[model samples]
Target: MTTTVRVLESSEEDVRRGPEIIIHENKYEFCRYNLKISRFINANLGFSAHVWDAGVALCRYFEKEKINFTGKKVIELGSGTGIVGILAALLGGYVTMTDKPKVLKQIETNVSINIPSVCRHRVNIRPLMWGENHTNFNPAYDFILGSDIVYSSVVYPALIETLRYLADQGATIYLSSELRKSNGSPDFHNNLLPHYFNCQVVDRIEGKDVVVYKMTKIATTSEEDPLPSKE
Candidate 1:
């Protein structure tokens, strides 16, 4: 017996549009946001942004889990198009959406238009280069979000270091990635073992080759001894 696989063709509407509105819904409400897409063929990758499947999976996972962001401090790494961070802010988180400096403007525009005036103050757009010194960023974030950031092996060390630097001891981390091999190995997931504990796959998209990971920082030992000798 032989098996056949079907591949669906993309429509012209899907190919031609520059910016499009993406609608995501949960049990309670719906989130409607516009995404700015890059039109120039020679434009930088950051400039030509579009929603990724992993990003959509993340949004759905958050909705299903009903993760409470109310009054919590959150940061998103490699926040292209800023969709995940925007969703967190909508759920009442004080969110910082960060990416390369070149992409900040696009994130800013999305935040300005999609985030309501009341929740506007809770959202900030900034530039973040992984593995670099980020002394200006607060070290106590309650939650960190990332989507499709693990596709490149070159960024693994820097990304892991940045995560360790930003996350508080009890901080929750949510990362989504498409299940695809990169540079011949899955270094992005494999490299995270040392710095994080209780790492688990919290969610998976049924038909999409995407998974979301929920992890917490490993407990660090104190540099100084607890017991002190009397003089």
Candidate 2:
């Protein structure tokens, strides 16, 4: 099968035209913990400005599992609109949301709008590029998260390296990705990731074709061969 592209709009707008805003109000369990997320979409911002199914699925999985994030040190990678990190903050985690330098503003806007004043201190937004020096971020995070980040084969090596660098001995990693071949290949989860980390499927959103995986670094021996190139 082949992928198809549709022109959903009449014509692409100029990058300088600014973003088109869309508000998403998400609530869980008896109207508690309402999160008003603002998604900025336009030609300039690319897919980083929009919410993907993987993000939504991860948010739902968090709610369903009722994971204890209270007082936990957490960081989210590729936090497009900061949805997962915001939700983590709402659940009492000290969360850092990160993405490319360009999209930090959008994540910051969403973080400010959703996180309550008293809890705002728990959330921090930062710029991160995979495979780059991340010395600014501590390696003691209790949890590392990503949604739809495994969207390209080109990023696998860097992504894995970053994960290995950030994760401490006991840190847990959660990643969610859509199963669509057009969006990304499954080989990252099925083949490459397992070599670096012990991976297991923790949640599957029915009908969404999205799966959430839990991972921890595999213990390495000095005699073990180096990881194969993901290029």
Candidate 3:
């Protein structure tokens, strides 16, 4: 599929046009944890992506010094706007930032925008399409990060399969998503988790707007490797 393109900056007759601005009365902050917004984190450059608010919130959850994140290998799937993966790099872990190859250029742009030069090396951006095989996949990671990815029923299985492929022996997966009705069917969490994964609710508190799930993979009886066997 051909991906849509949005220029970072546009100018006409020396007049500057910026990315469309989206304002939320209940706007949540993820660009920075403190009162100040760092230019590196929030480009103020533009808001072309989806609810980056969720990404900001997820990044805040990691940035707050509340969790012990050290020496872990992390990967963020469907990394739109690449916010969560960037935060993982900032938090002192090796993080792989993934999306389709076509979208990686801007994701790389976003990472370089926020993180220091030394830290930028720690972030690896790779191409990954759901359910399809990629040549350069590393078999293990300590965590899988995803947000708002469980919308389509067809893609849900593929997304879960992709995560299952990268999950390490004991690595945990974290996902944040809002409940939405779909085609007269149950939501992703309600309909999918029970069959493929052993899921536990990490947070479902009132007014938080999204549910965070601590997902652990369920082993299959098929005993088959999804990827080609190691040489």
TM-scores for candidates 1 onward, in order: 0.76, 0.84, 0.72
Q: Name the lDDT value of residue 56 in candidate 3.
A: 49
lDDT of all the models against the reference? 0.68, 0.76, 0.60
Task: Write the candidate numbers in order of decreasing lDDT.
Answer: 2, 1, 3
Model 3 agreement with the true structure over 56-132: per-residue lDDT tens digits: 45555554435544588888887867767776777777888887775576577667666689777788988888778
RMSD, every candidate, angstroms? 8.6, 6.3, 9.1
lDDT by residue for model 2 (97-145), tens: 9999888888888778788799999998889998886667788999999
Q: Candidate 3 overall Cα lDDT vs. reference?
A: 0.60
- The local lDDT score (0 to 100) that residue 228 gets in candidate 2 is 52
Clashes of each: 1, 0, 0
Model 1 Cα lDDT, one tens digit per residue, 65-149:
6777999999999887777888888888999899888777667766776777877989888888887755579878899999887
Off by over 4 Å in 2: 1-31, 182-184, 221-225, 228-231
Q: What is the lDDT of residue 165 in candidate 1?
A: 71
Better of 2 and 3 by lDDT: 2
Candidate 1 TM-score over all chains jointly: 0.76
User: How far does residue 160 in candidate 2 sit from its true spot (Å)?
Assistant: 0.3
Q: After superposition, how far is residue 31 of candidate 3 from its true place, in Å?
A: 9.6
Residue-level lDDT for 227 in candidate 1: 13
